[model samples]
Structures are given as C-alpha cells and as structure tokens.
Target: MLLVTGITGHTGKYFLKELINNKYQGVIRCVVRETSDTSLLDNSGLNIEKVVGNLNDKSFVEQIMPGVEAIMHIYNIHHSPVIVETAIKNKVKRAILVHTTGIYSNFKYASQEYKNVEQKVFELTKQKECPTKVTILRPTMIYGDICDSNMSKFIKMVDKLRVIPVINKGESLLQPVNARDLGKAFFNVLLSPTETSGKVYDLSGEKPIKMIEVFRIISKEFNRQTTFVSVPLSLGELLAKSIKIITLGRINYVEKVQRMGEDRSYSHINARNDFGYNPMSLEEGIRIEVKEYLEAKDIR
Candidate 1:
C-alpha cells in the first residue's frame, strides 16, 4: 500500500491529479484533517482510502504505518521528523518527502524552524542501520492556479491595483516552480526510487527572472498599463511595521518585504539529469494562472 499526506492542499492536489492521469494501479491511502475538503478525491475515479487524523499524533501515525510500503509526504516540512521516525520504526521501505528551498533563506525568523526540522529528518534517515530509503525534493515558490497562496494573491493585487510597490526597484531574482511541474516531479521520483533515494533535488523553474519582469509579465497578461513605485529598503520596512501595528498584528508584511530584496533562485539540473524533470517557463505558467483568475472572476 502507498500512503499520501496533504492530499487536499495546493501541491498535493496536483500530485493526486498526476496519479489519476497516469492510471496508477496501486492502492493509495491519504491522511487528511477532519475539516479538510475531500470533494476532489471523491470525484476522482481512482480507488482511494481516506483516513481522518493528524500526523503529529504518534499513535495515529503508527496505526496507519503497518501495511504502508512507501509514503509520499507532501505535507509541511515541520512534520517530517515524526513521519520519518515512525516510518523507520514500522520498517517502511521507501519514502519521498517534499521540502522547500526556503531553508536557505537568510531570514532567521522563517528559515530557522525549517532548518531544524530538516536536520532531524536527515539524522534519522542517515542512521547506520536505517532501512528506509528517503529522497527529499526541495521546490522553489510554487504557483499554478487560484489555490496557490503566493502568486495568486499577487495576481489579484495586480488586477485590482495597477500600482505595484517595490523595494530596491524589484531587482531581486526569483525562480518559481509551477505546481503542475512539481506534481510530475513527485510522480517521476516515486517511479525511480533507486536513482533518487539518498539524494536531494532542487525543483525550480526554467530560469530565474527579475521581480520587475514578473510584474511586467502579469501586467502584459492583463493588458493593463501599470505603474511601478520604488521604495527604499529601510523605508519599506518601516511602513510594513507601521501597518502591522495599525492592524493590531492582524496584517504582517515585515518578512515579506524583507524577503523581496533577497534572491531566491535555485538550479534543477540534478533533478533533470536523474529523473528527466522539466518544468514550464514562468510566462507560460503565469498565462494559465491569469486565465484561471479571469474565468473565476467572470463566474462571480
């Protein structure tokens, strides 16, 4: 049996779609929260078993690990240590984990926890007698459709407000991976466990582009004339803090502004060489996202 987690989330949903599209013949089981919406899984014609529980609970994880031969954990990286320990204890053979490139971020507040959790997982899997072969995939910022948390909000903001605020004139580079490409990567890794096991791969986009180019692409997609306003790094940080204080901590953009000035590009050459991984260009992916956004807007 194959076990999957985060089946209802942004990237997980795409991974599930890949499995369905390929007509996977294995029995698959997914762990989801009680409040998670399973309409997608229900509508899928694949045979899948749904278990309602949290991965943080040791007993709950143990109960589900008995017959699971391989686990595809698409959930938060923080839960990886627990899952790795339980999978090792249960003697599961192979495991695939979805992590992030954010662990390399210079932002201490956000990157510290990710680094710590990933460290624990690495230690567990590198033990002398460890039986499970674990492969880790670190994807860059994921954006594909309306469900994405990153570019979707940016798209909406650009559509509604034609003026974009930038720090350091938005020159920092970013390479975002589309959710569809990421899903296909997961499926490819699952198929080639021998080649991917005990290795880490960076799943990035076709190439890195400047933040200003991103804005221009979105504006071109919408066919709207947009204006770019530049803000000094220090002044932008001050305004972000002021906004947070004014909203009584409800809205926080301090880290968001800080990260905008940092480069977030990575290479997927190893992934391409190992698993034949290829991702779509940012322009093509953004076009799809903009289409989805416009269609949804028309519906409402």
Candidate 2:
C-alpha cells in the first residue's frame, strides 16, 4: 500500500493518476482533511481511498498505518512532519518527500516558516533512524492552466494589461516544469530499493530559459502586445518589502516573488539521471498553458 499525502493538490492528482494509469499493482490511498472539498477529485473515484483526517491527528492516523507499505509525501508544511514521523514509527518501507527548489534559487523569497518545515523534516528523518528510506525532490515554478499564481498571474495579465513590469532586460532565467513528468519519478524512486534513501533531487525541465523570451513567445502566440518597464533589482526588492508592510504583512507575496531574480536557472540532469525524470521545455509548456487560459477566458 502506497499512502500519498497532499493527494488533493494539482501535482498530487497528476501523480496519483499517473500511478493508476501505468497500472501499478499496489493499493494507493490518499490522505485528505475531513473537511476537505472532494469535488475536484470526483473524477478519480473509488480507486483513491480518501483517508480523512488532519495532519495534526496522530492517534487516529496511527490506526491506519498497519498495512502501509511506503508513503509518497507531497506535504511541505511544518505540521506535515507528523505524518512522516508516524510513517517512520510504523516501519513503512519508503518515503518520497516532495520538497521545493526554493532551498536553492530564490530561497530568500521563502518565509521563515517554509524553511523551518524543511529543516524539521530533515531532523526527524535523522532522529528516527526510520526504516522508511526517504527521498526528496525540489520542483520549481510549477504551472498549468488552472493556476493564476506566480508566472501564471503574469501570463493572464499580458492581454488584459498592456504594460508589464519587467526587470533588467526581462531575461531572468526560468525552468518551468509541467506536472505530467511526475509519474515515473515516484515509481522509480520506490523501485530504487535503498539507494534513494536520504537523497534529494532538484527536478526541472532540461532547458532553463530567460523569462523575457518565455513571455515574448507566449505573447506572440496569443497576439498580445505588452509594454516593459525596467526596475532595478534592488528597487524590486525594496518594493516587495514595502508591499509586505503596506498590506499589514498579509501581502508579503511580492517579498518572496522578487527573489526569483537570484539564480532562477538550474540543471535537471540530476533528476534525469536518477529516475529518468525529464520535463518538457518551456515552449511546449507555454503552448499548452496559453491555449487553455485563452479557451477558459472565452467561456467566462
């Protein structure tokens, strides 16, 4: 039995579907909050055993840990470590920890709580001497049509707002990975036996390109005209910090976003080499994203 947390999220849906589509002959159970809205996952019915409970509930969760084989951990928050600790205590075979590449690029953009969660996971993994071999993956700037977050927000604004905020030639590097390349990743990691234990993989598409070029290609595809503004990197950071204050700390999203300028580019060869996990290029991804975004807007 492979237990998957965060099973209701975008990446989790794709991962679970991929597992079932490829015909993995194993029981796949999905963790969900008791109050979680299951309308989105209605398509992937009965196959997904919706384990209802919050991550905070340790005792009730422990009851279901008996027959568990391995766990695909798509969780990242601090409270989520409870699941891993329990998984380890229950002697689950393997754990695939889905982490973020913010540990590298734009790490400064991360809130103190985010990094704390990562550290706690690592520490718990070390302390338990847990029998479950743990593997970590860092996925950066993940996107698709359903998203209006991060770069997707910029993509949606291109046609509506003629002018866009572009920085320093608008060429910051981006390695946007599609959600589909996730199937083989978890399967392969589970197949690695013990070699994958305690290993962390930085996952991304093979090619990382400049953000300006990415926007330009998408703009041309959509017949959108966009004006660019040059904001100094330092000014961008200051603006972000100010937004954090002006919004009474509720709108610190820019504080984290502006940090994307630092080393946004990375090589996914490691992920490719490890589990044959290769993501599609930015062009192919954008083509799909823009098409969907346009179609959805038409219906709206």
Candidate 3:
C-alpha cells in the first residue's frame, strides 16, 4: 500500500490520476484534511482509502505509517521531518518527498527553510541506524493547471494588463515542468524505490526559455497584441518593496524582484537517467494550460 499526502493539490491530483491511468495495483491511502475536496479521488475510480486528519499530528501519522510500503509526501515541508521519522519507526521501506527547485535559488526565506528540511531528511536517512530509504525530488516552476502559480498567474496577468512588464529585459530563463509530468516522475521513482533511494533529483522541462519568450508564448496563446515594457530590475525592486509595505507582507517583494534577474533553469539529466523523467515542451504545456484556462473562464 502507498501512503500519499496532499492528494487533493494540483500535483497530488495529477499524481493520483497517473496512478489510476497506469493501473497501479497498490492500495493508496490518502491523508488529507477533513474539509479537503475529495472529488478528484472520488472520480478517479481507483483503490483509495481516504484518511481525513492533520499530518502534523504525530499520533495520527504514526498510526497510519505501519504496513505502508512507501510514502509520497507532496506538501507541508515543515511536517516532513516528523513524517519521515514516523515512517522510519513504522518500518516503511521508502519515502519520497516532492520539494521545489526554488530551494537552490537565492530566495532567502524559502531557500533556507527548504535547505533545512533537505538537510534534516538526508541526515536522518543516511544513518545506518535508520532503515527507511528516502528520496527527494525538486521540481522547477510547475505549470499545467489553472491552480498552478507560475503560468496560470502569467496567463491572468497577460489577460488583464494592457502593457505587460518584463524586468531586466526578461533575460533570466525558466524551465517549467508540467504538473502531469511531475506526477509521472513521482510514480517512476516509486516503482524504482531502491534505485532512487538516498538521491536528490532536479526535475525540469526539456528546454530553458527566456522570460521574454515566455511572455510572448502566453501572449500568443491569449491571441492579444500585448506591449512589452522592459523595466529595470532596481526600479522593479523598489516598486515591489513599496507594494510589499502597502500589502502588509502579503507578498514576497524582494524574492519576486530578485528572481526576475536570476536564471531558474536546471538540468534534469539525473532524473531522466534514473527514472525516465521526460517532460513536455514549454509551448505545448502552456498551450494546454491556456486551453484549460479558456474553458474554465468561458472565454474563446
């Protein structure tokens, strides 16, 4: 049986769909909050046992950890250390943590936090005293659904803004992995538990594209002649900081502006070699996202 957390999220839903499409024989135990929408799982028509509870609760996690061959934890990095520890205690064979490639970036808060989590998990799993093998997958900017943060936000921005802004000539590159492909990568890692164990893989798209080209792609998808304004990074950071103050820290102004000038592209060679992580092209992926967005918004 496989224990999956965050089965209702964008990636989780896709992962469950992949598991169903591939006809995975294992019984899946999904741990989600009581109020989480299980419609995706309900419609999946796969072998799934739903557990409604908080993963932060040690007792609840410990109770469900036994007899589970592998665990794919897709959310809540803060709770991962405890979850991995419990899995080790219960003799679970393998654990896969779906992290983000942002950890490798210059973002201060998120990078430090993810680094801590990675360090903790790796240190624990490396101990000969611990039996449960752990594998970590870091996926770059995921974008395939209306619920995604990267392309979806770009789609909405391009849909609204008369003149879209591109910071630092938008020269920084991004390689976005489709959420569906990320799900497949998780499944592949699960199948080759021994091969992927104790390893960290960076899952990204096939090619890195400039941010300017990204905006062009989205604009093309929207079928709108949008004007591009190349804003200086320093000025953008100033505006972002001001907005941050006005928004009462609701947004990450520094990270957002700084990341605009830094390349976010990463190599997926290791993941491809280990687990056959083949992601769709950015153009095709964004086209799918645009189609879905148009359908959802009832717009042609």
Q: Worst lDDT window (10 residues) for model 1?
A: 107-116
TM-score, every prediction: 0.97, 0.88, 0.96
Over 1-300, each residue of candidate 1 has an lDDT whose tens digit, in order, gives 899999899989989999989998877899999899999898888889999998878899888988899999999888888898999998999889999999889963869988898889889988989989999999999999998999898799789997888789989999999999999999999999889998999999999999889989999999999899988888998999999999999999998888898999999999999999999999999999999999999999
Candidate 2 lDDT: 0.71
Q: lDDT per residue, candidate 2, 43-160, as tens digits?
A: 6544556677766667866866778988887855454577677887888877788877776644464556667777777787787356767777778777755562655776777767
Positional deviation of residue 148's Cα in model 3 after best superposition, in angstroms: 1.0
Worst 10 residues of 3 by lDDT: 101-110
Residue 204 in model 1: lDDT:
95
**Candidate 3, residues 1-300: lDDT per residue as tens digits?**
899998899898888888888988868999988789998888787888988888767899988887898999998777889988888888888889988888988755689988898888877787787889888889988888899978899999888997988898889999989999988999899999767998989999889999999999999998889888999989998998988899998975787788888899999999988888889999999899999998988864
Angstrom error at residue 95, model 2: 0.6
Q: Count the backbone clashes (under 3 Å) in each candidate.
A: 0, 0, 0
Q: Which candidate comes out best when scored by lDDT?
A: 1
lDDT of 3: 0.88
Candidate 2: Cα lDDT at 169: 63
Candidates sorted by lDDT, best first? 1, 3, 2
